[model samples]
Target: MSGSWAGGRFGERGECLLAPNPGIMTLDGTNTWVLREPGSSTAVVVDPGPVEDGHLERLDEETGDVGLVLLTHHHLDHSEVAATFAARKGCAVRALDPAHCVGADPLADDEVLSVGGLSLRVVATPGHTADSVSFLLPTERVLLSGDMVLGRGTTVVAHPDGRLGPYFDSIERMRSLATAGEVATIWPAHGPVHDDAGAVLDHYLAHRRDRLAQVAAAVERLRDEGATPTPRAVVEVVYADVDEILWGAAELSVRAQLEYLAERAS
Candidate 1:
């Protein structure tokens, strides 16, 4: 998981077409997954990704006939070309958010989508963003975790739209799936794929709890020092080891943590 995650086929029915866009935030770029059952004539595309013309063209050429396009969320990096790509393939785009859907109704939680003999169960995992969703391939015991979980690092709990309470709940839900043996592998939308789903879910939960505790302690320490326990101030203390360039993302999580703490107190 430390090295670069070059896109390639995985599991029995999934292939990762890594988008060209990559950065600190995107890691190895948005993973545009092509899911098709063996011997199927058409495929299903997930998170069509950015507006890269070459990427879209490659998807069109490589995938042949795409039956449908699904979005994990409405983030520009993930869904910027969903509608356009779907239209080109003569398919409909489905997402948790209606605004992002094209020629198709919004996806419902627990909805079972069957295409090209592949079965994908929609799991609403709103945390990284309110519209975030994960697709569960029961036959493969794989979860296509959008931005809710990443292959390399922790996901940012984008505040305002992303709530800490919901984020925690979502992680817990995923953890339960892992514990129940329903999810054995995580085919995330970013970075590499994880074979140990339970371990990863546990790590994510523990990391969040550790960060929350650290944030709480930092707030108390700042208050005792007669300094306002602002999000940035708490972030400086809690995320001291993190790079300054990622402070903006840390601040968003800090804000969400603060809000979660406030709500719990009330």
Candidate 2:
């Protein structure tokens, strides 16, 4: 039991089954969500999580007769076992990316899917990755925030597949959802459930802004010293506080920051 998670039932129709693959990156491991309507025979599982046999067995025991499998993104940790698991459960796997889906079409924005009687409205929130998405469960006012939002700390907007502009837009969209009273809680894919949706969104937005500003300042300082302000150089100055193991992840975000700055200049 990590300080950030305790695997428990959340909202009116969801439960979290914490995976065994916890680490510096995946805090308390990946969260496999099981959602079902009251007295409904069918359930929907989200983020099947790595292809670990024990994890799959635990999920099978925790969620019986799964009707649909939903994926937030194509990250291996979250989507590796999805197709196999969905096949085992006799269900269709739907994701934003066609390659990740099995025997079903990719999801679209505002697309609503049902499991028994509960519904999940797909919210396209690409930032963490181009295919990243979040689900809004209107009945419980809970949002299944994939990697777009984490239950603890902040998320990395790694480059190539991630962009600062779209990431900010996605967070703003989620904030708008909270402001409109469409969502009140966050059912993140990692860590524990967040009770205050408004505060979490505010923090996520603030943290991204703060980090970008800090990275910008670092870039300026590096340039003043007549040195190249590359992503690795910027990481040394901006991500000094982060562990060396996470420097690789930090560098990825730094790359995205550099691209965003370059676009602004252009």
Candidate 3:
């Protein structure tokens, strides 16, 4: 909250603004983005962050006239305040899910949504959440990656709603965009902005592959040591370097890893 709201220009047709909401679960706060059409005053707001009063007020103050409020997913941290904020701005809340969506317009994969002369191409990026999506601003070659890719660390594939194979596939999809030079920058839902879209995508892909390998190794080690292959035991051995506080989250990852291994073996 101390730093001034940072805004930057993306190519000729788009502008990106970041509102950092630092705290638990939010990492360096959620990155609330405002993408506007060049030379236009109206803008589209993405992932308004948590429903904190201050954050909402700051969003209103920063984005003078919002043409739309779009949620990348239905997570509370991202869309909890969508209804209130959309009502305040007299804009409709567009999302993939109806439960969290303020209006009836459900976002479709490959859908082109426009506001104020700027358009965002929706890319279905499930596995972070079933409803998770990434927005591609083709004109600027910038992607609003929601929780699919984080500026730092890997995103949790919150299971039940998230899965490993699909998550890997989603990363590959983003990687294709970067490799094709269709995306140059990543405006993630959390943490700082990333300019090296291709490199970031590569890193995310590598990280997940390495993690799967590590999980497999950990399971093998447990077998070698005659340790029970329970989820808790695997988490303890595999995530020993991770903070104890995050073990719960690690356990979820371990579960996903186990499922992956099980499926592969079958």
Q: How many clashes (backbone N, Cα, C below 3 Å) per candidate? A: 0, 0, 2
Q: Is candidate 2 or candidate 3 better by lDDT?
A: 2
Q: Which residue pairs come into collision in candidate 2?
A: none
Write down the lDDT that model 1 would get. Answer: 0.93
What lDDT score belongs to each candidate, Candidate 1 first?
A: 0.93, 0.90, 0.81
Model 1 C-alpha lDDT per residue in residues 130-249, reported as the tens digit of each score: 999999999999999999999999999999899899998999999899989999999998999999999999999999999999999999999999999999999899989989999999
Q: Which stretches of candidate 3 lie over 4 Å from their true place?
A: 1-20
After superposing candidate 2 on the true structure, give the runs of residues whose Cα lies further than 4 Å from its correct spot: 1-4
Look at candidate 1 and tell me the lDDT of residue 264. Answer: 94
**How close is every model to the real structure, measured as TM-score?**
0.98, 0.97, 0.91
Better of 1 and 2 by lDDT: 1
Candidate maximizing lDDT: 1
Colliding pairs, model 3: 21-29, 22-29
Candidates sorted on TM-score, descending: 1, 2, 3
